[model samples]
Target chain A: MKDERTVPARTATQVKIADAAIRVIAQRGFDVVSVRSVAQQSGLSAGTVQYHYRTRQDLLLAALERSVARQAERIRTVGRVESYRESMALTLRELLPLDGVRYEDAAVWVSYGAAAATRDWLAGPYWSGMRLFHDGVRETLERARADGRLREGLTPETAAPLVTALVNGLTLDHLNAPARVRVEVEAALDRGLRLILRD
Target chain B: MKDERTVPARTATQVKIADAAIRVIAQRGFDVVSVRSVAQQSGLSAGTVQYHYRTRQDLLLAALERSVARQAERIRTVGRVESYRESMALTLRELLPLDGVRYEDAAVWVSYGAAAATRDWLAGPYWSGMRLFHDGVRETLERARADGRLREGLTPETAAPLVTALVNGLTLDHLNAPARVRVEVEAALDRGLRLILRD
Candidate 1:
């Protein structure tokens, strides 16, 4: 799960181009994310963007790759919270679109995920991200159990997918109804965790 | 929820065109859904298709309207069940892609949902379908409460959004990982319901 083309940006130019792809996808949606538009967004020549990305698919992959890595890295570096609820609140909130950066990442994920329904090559990276995220949630739940923060009869193996699904669902709702859901996202996250942990 | 441009197909030709749009969106994704392609899929001329639905947006709306109306009508006509679990099981399962027609609706909803992230006009029907679906689940939960099937302290207001989120999440996951998640969608739905109802 961790090793599926999870490479970070290899150069400053590549990172810029990838960011440009994300901006294009976030602002105009993925259908308009061409090399020229990305290059224009990044204030670089189409030749330069093409040289780095090689194709439109490559550009999208880089954007997805960078977004996943950033979230994973953020979660990896977080300090532990006191209780299971705060722990979940921190970890799951990372998965939601609380800020602009995460919002764009989610936009890329949701938009591309919708398109990936009929596009196989586009789904590979998303699956990797999904697995990596599921593993991360499972690990967090395991820690809660070890730290005596878990409820009896609840296991990490069972709870991990539910947490991820709730997070996924919340994110989807947020994307479709940002104005209403944006405020409710954290509250919704906490509410779902309450049902999961019964805390 | 039911009145947001929720018009069903007004003619046989339009219904044919709407079904073709569904086939195109289901088979090839919404990005490639056009009047010409839908016309070809329906074995009709572009001019005839245009005469019915004028533009690609109009054609897509017709497809969405038909899909949403079909699901809504099906759920509205369901017979009563024994328990909340059975009631939710039946209603929520109706939202899933268990068969061909529902699969196409799920495909259209998922793909266009992703695209609607950036397309304002595209999201209108989705919001309506979402509201209608939410109201349906809320009503089911209300029935469960009246029948004395709901667990203590769980209200319809609190559980409705969560239930809808679980259904939404399962649909999103199935869209991305059909081979693995298809078999699990029902089981997952049941598990989520158990968490909510303790039944």
Candidate 2:
């Protein structure tokens, strides 16, 4: 039988490279980040990084996949909350840049998003990630409406987009103005929840 | 001394450089753009571009200043509308990425914003642009409340953040998922307008 050592070792190396790429891209953005930088960060050779990922775009795509997977896993693990307001608030607050890791993730995602705008090849996964996020919001709202936890006249079809926008907009605001405008974000979140949740 | 011609020529050259830098940065982002690229795009010598702007960050700052000035000028020129609803719609629409030029500006602003998160030197102008955008939204909401155009329970302080978040979130959604979810954005905009506007 052929040696199985190469397979596990290669997989571990790929994960290390991807993690290092995430940190480097988070700090410098996709456009400025180089393969050599990833290698430096990962403590691997440039040749090794290239061996695992064919191009820089490939590496970024892997990273994007990893991020979306993490988000999906979070949603899955968190599952559903008892109340509509708590569910939406919990999902949004989890996604926001409330801590260092999420903040770095937000920064990296924004950079990827900007690059995706110009590069059509990168749009597919990026767009899919956004759709998944929106769909989750819509699903949560629909469940709440079905359970009679949300107010009348506000279907998931109507409320989902608003909630998605509110969460995303508040996240962007927080990322841009972390110090002075955080309270404003919290207030908006509270008001948004109050507006939709049934008494 | 030199000549009276120097001042006008300098001003004209500065305008050319700023316009070129905006185009380049908007296309490739601030970190990826360079003085030589700006010079080539502007049809100026590298020395001339270098002579006018000391560094890429300086060039980006000047371009950012021009963008903010132009946005402020647009709001000024648009002046006050007959009603608060019209004014808010007008301002919010301007922020959207519906057209090509505005899309480019929005994209570039986002890219610069990512950079500004880490680079302290760019933070001041970045935050100021954000403030200008926020203040415009706030003032419009305040005017609406003053004129009894908005619902009784919503004050400017409360409505401003919500409105801002809604518009920004919709714009981001429109950019990210133009094909699949553009209609959702329009619906959200309408719902948001209805939430604040008087019957």
Candidate 3:
């Protein structure tokens, strides 16, 4: 019989290991991410870390999965009082490296993305997560179009990729220019959204 | 006196070494780019490559310089027949991985960008090249605005970053999804530009 406590404890330890991998990747380059480093970062023995994630690739994949889930969750629940446009702005902002946690997420994302470029196996999850994000943008745009808020001649099919690209580009820019004003980025996003979505 | 012929030969050999480094980075992940691999790719001895490059950092910086210079040159000469909008499109296209050579350029670019994200020394060239690209986009948009071809309420200052971001994002996405249709991406780019620029 499985102990009830074991499930929760195992999950908690896995999450800790994943978070530690993200931190290591964020601080060091992706090449530096290994079982030893993650173990040290998590304050657990190497054996314990390996038991959960046998290889660096396993740890990286876990971190990416968690990051994608957390990001998707942020956009899943549209606030009761928030307009679609406002909700979108908030969702896109969640993808940006505006805060420390987000910056770490962005850093690890870039590293993982680079690694995924040459590694075929990692490409599946990388593209899937991106497709999901792009789909979310399309759904939002379609909803706005249905409500007659979207500008004429602008289809969600065509606009969603641009939005996806913009968020990614902005994330990369923000990573290098950490001191860049949040208002400026938000203004860019607002202006971009406004161009597509009528006031 | 030193042989005058040696000068041209040495320069050609250095260029070959640099090109090989770019090819190595493009084919393999950035982590795999070593002095020896670059030498092997160049069809030169390790000693000969090392004599010129000295270190991997030196080789990387040289490759980046060459790539940036090549890209800048592509945008430097805007033909008289090309409209500002057309010229802008051409300039931006230079940044895309549209063809084999450009794909190589883009691959090396992604690898360098990922490395730069973690390395402070790399951050300088990374940001500088980006700033240069951003400035070019801004200049093109400003020219369009001056000609009254820009949409109402859209300033070059406001739109240039979006264009820059789109190109970067598209580049990263294309690196992963190489099979993505060229027309689809071009359509997205066109739609994006049309949103900001008057028809």
Candidate 4:
């Protein structure tokens, strides 16, 4: 039987289509993402795009896989720090909309969150990415606790998921009101972390 | 000069169309919400729907206005209380996706939040509604402090907005993974609030 977990090898054309799909989703909301739109954005023929992705979901899945890989690589680079406080800040901020690229990525994730609210098939991947992020926060919190860097009377299990939600909420506010939230984003993160992390 | 703040009178046809638009958005996602879609959802002729609401934005704005008024009324009813903790819980819980109607409202707000990321016109309303909600949280926090019910070392100004983001984050998480988040939603809110509010 074919391995459902294994991603098929992607050709250069497929890569181009996937990039185009992400750009399309980032530029116009995910609602306008289609094979034709991706093809137009990629400067290729509709049939060429179709041969690679076959459907809109196929295109989005490929784009999401790439985005997830890049994000995971980023978080991995920040792992194994001496100070869980610094590591915690970096890892969580990596998920925030701090730059143009991250902003677009956040936009796609937020739109998909809404789109997946009704599409059950999309929820699996959404939950997977979120669970992965949440686990990272939990690990950071646990490490901080072990190192005595976390405040007393707080458990990682209880606080980690809450931190995940706080970042998610802050990201939402930042994407929607960048100017208003930009000045306070870093400060807000520090304030939140201070509640559990030692000064 | 025309009064921009005063909403024009809504006929029965307009009210029906607005309700149809909300349902359409709640079920099909906002991408499919157009005059024709709302018309079909409302069982009204396209021309009839068009006559009352000239554009998709008009229909959406009407629906949002109705939704906002209803949400505000619900929040207003929960305004004053003997305990700020209980009041905070109730007020914030009103915004959570705890039921079908609230699930639909959060879906629409989250979708608009993503949609407004690039659209300047939509951003105004998005920020306005969010700012209104944030203001209420700030006021509640101040009241909690005056009553000596808030935890020490916390300012309403600093903590209120973070609480706003926390709830926003929790709402997003709940909508995406209802089963996983439903069990922990209330407890999560209490934990975050406890960081600021006294026991």
Candidate 5:
């Protein structure tokens, strides 16, 4: 079996198709994502796209996998820090769709999540990505506890879900309301974290 | 020319089609909600369904509007209470997807909200439902403030989003994890509310 930890090798054509699939999902939502549309968007023939991804699920899964990998990498970059509070605030903010690219990524994730609700096959990607993000939050909270930076009564296990949910809720709100100011979004995050973290 | 607040009188056939649309959305997700599928599920002809709805949005929006009306009515029935704390808790609990029917409602809302991300026309149902729910929370908070039951530092404006987001997040989590217990979901909400409201 191919190791999920490592990014699978892809030809340039496959990469193009995957990128096109992401754009289609981000722009039109996931249910509308099809091989023909991805091909049209990629400026390639339908057969070429088909050859790269034999089915619609194959194509969309590739796009979902790539997005999750990139998001993991972004979270991983926030290495050991002097303050878990600052590190967390910085990392969670990265997940917010404050700009165009981030908005597209958030939109695709939301689309995938919605589809995954009913389709059992799609649950793997959705849960795995969520696990990674939740684990990251737990790790950050644990570090704060170790360093005595976290509030006296709080534990990572309890706080992780709140933080994860806050970000998820905020991301959805931000994507739907494009007119929302970044300051308000950031402020919401800060307020949530303060409730969990120490002063 | 239709007053949105007024539920349009539906023939038995129209009502059947609308119920089928809700099932389709709850079981299959919203992306597949079309006049043809709804008709197939309802055992009615597509042309008959179309005659009532005029457009796909009209049909789905009707279903959505009906669901919101039912949810609001449920919240309204929570009635006068000795304390804002008890009233708020009782009202918000109605929003949780604790049972099968409630779960279906929450799932359809999430699916519709996800699709509404890219479809501008669908924004009406999405935002209007959200506004009603948010306003309910704000109204509870305002009542608490008037009764002097609210925490000293909390403002309805700030607390409403946090409460709203927490419920939204918890609903999403519960839907994804069907084995989730009602107690845990209720506890999460209680914890979140405690953080926002005074004892």
Candidate 6:
């Protein structure tokens, strides 16, 4: 009976732990991060972290959910732009690891995504988020096509995956080799957009 | 001294440990994997793994080097292919998680790559390997351009990054969503080739 009353409180604590876990994981990575680290980061006890997430894997799963949710929120918040180019450019720019926190988040997400590939249980939400992001990009391409802003012979269904891939790949490059040749990434994006956009 | 004769043997043993580490890390992730797991995979004692690599991080780094070396070998082999389309197709195809072993390797590399993003010590070889791959693609594009097979305006430098990004992103999408949409990633490649190829 008392467990019922504690449910809401427990859920709140779980959320806190998840959020803290994300930050800690993002900074130190899943490999080096410990339950104590997450607890310390969140200003909670190790017992509380254990109470919410029985194992390190469980904590990672919760952290992944929180991370994906934040990314989805960011995607949703991208307001309507005047042009297709503007919309894509804005959305993609936001997705890039242009800053410290975003870079850490991207890094952590990539790690989790890799783990998800082998483990079916971990793969579900990460894969779904990827699909949703792909779909959203496709919808944007479709809107551009309907507006006659895109070139002829291009379909959103076909182009969406390609565009998403380009953005993602470029993001990885940007993170991997920013000092040496990141400007090329921007140029590549421009060229890709030129290929699809109406002359 | 007797230590001089043991140097070669020690180096050989370290190589074996490194090779085994890749297999273990690929099966389990960098986080879940331990020195003992690597030692077990290598058929060596845990003491041997520790003797070669002082910590789990060191073993992970060694495994990363082995992964890079294998990928570099794959790239070098592909360089022998004559046709541009054939070479590009081969390279992109290899990047896909088409098989269990390759999938595991990709998963492990991606996880390590993500971790490397935050830690400077882990960044070197990973970034170098990426750059090497990028350079190889750029050289391929350059050859195509010299043969007058590519479009007039597009240079290798301009097209290489975009093509690289597109292929990488497509591979990621395929990995994440194998069931829902049969995204013909090759379509993106075809379109990209067409955009850059002369009529």
Candidate 5 lDDT for residue A13: 69
lDDT of 4 by residue, A92-169 (tens): 777777776676677777877788887887888888888888887888788778878877667898888678878888
B-chain TM-score for every candidate:
0.89, 0.82, 0.87, 0.88, 0.85, 0.78
Candidate 5, residues B84-161, lDDT tens digits: the string is 766677777777777765776777777776788878887766887888888888988887788777765678887777
**Model 1 Cα lDDT, one tens digit per residue, A14-80:** 7888888888888888889888999899999998887777777788888888778777777777676
Stretches of candidate 4 exceeding 4 Å from the true structure = A1-16, A43-48, A79-81, B1-13, B178-180
Fraction of true interface contacts that also occur in model 1: 0.50
TM-score-better candidate, 4 vs 6: 4
Q: Which regions of candidate 1 deviate over 4 angstroms?
A: A1-8, A147-154, B1-8, B77-79
Weakest 10 consecutive residues of candidate 5 chain A by summed lDDT = A2-11
Interface RMSD, Å, model 3: 1.3
Model 3, range A66-102, lDDT digits (tens) per residue?
Answer: 7777677766763533466677777787777667667
Which ten residues in a row are the worst by lDDT in model 2 chain A?
A3-12
**Candidate with the greatest DockQ versus the true structure:** 4
Better lDDT candidate (2, 3): 3
Lowest lDDT 10-residue stretch of candidate 3 chain A: A1-10
For each candidate, the alpha-carbon lDDT, in order, equals 0.77, 0.70, 0.75, 0.77, 0.74, 0.69
Which residue pairs in candidate 4 collide? none
Per-candidate DockQ vs. reference: 0.62, 0.50, 0.63, 0.70, 0.59, 0.53
Write one digit per residue (lDDT tens) for candidate 6, span A1-199. Answer: 3433212113778878877877786677776556888899999999878877777777777777776666667767877678787667766666666666566556656776666766777677777777777888888888888889876667887677677777777766666664657556666776777766653
**TM-scores for every predicted model:** 0.91, 0.85, 0.90, 0.90, 0.88, 0.82
lDDT per residue for candidate 3 within B1-199, as digits (tens), equals 7633212113878878878877877777777767899899999999888777777787887777667766777667635334665566666777777776677777777777778878987888877887888887888788889889888888889988888878877877767774754446666676777777774
Give residue B63's error in model 5 in angstroms.
2.0
Worst 10 residues of 4 chain B by lDDT: B2-11
Candidate 4, B1-199: lDDT as tens digits = 8643224217767767777887888788887889899989999999987777777777777776666655677888876566678778877887777777677787877887788876776778788888888888899888888889767667888887689888888888778885856768888887888777874
Candidate 2, residue B39: Cα displacement in angstroms equals: 2.4
lDDT of 2 by residue, B80-160 (tens): 567667666766666665666566566666666667766777777778887778777778777777778877567777877
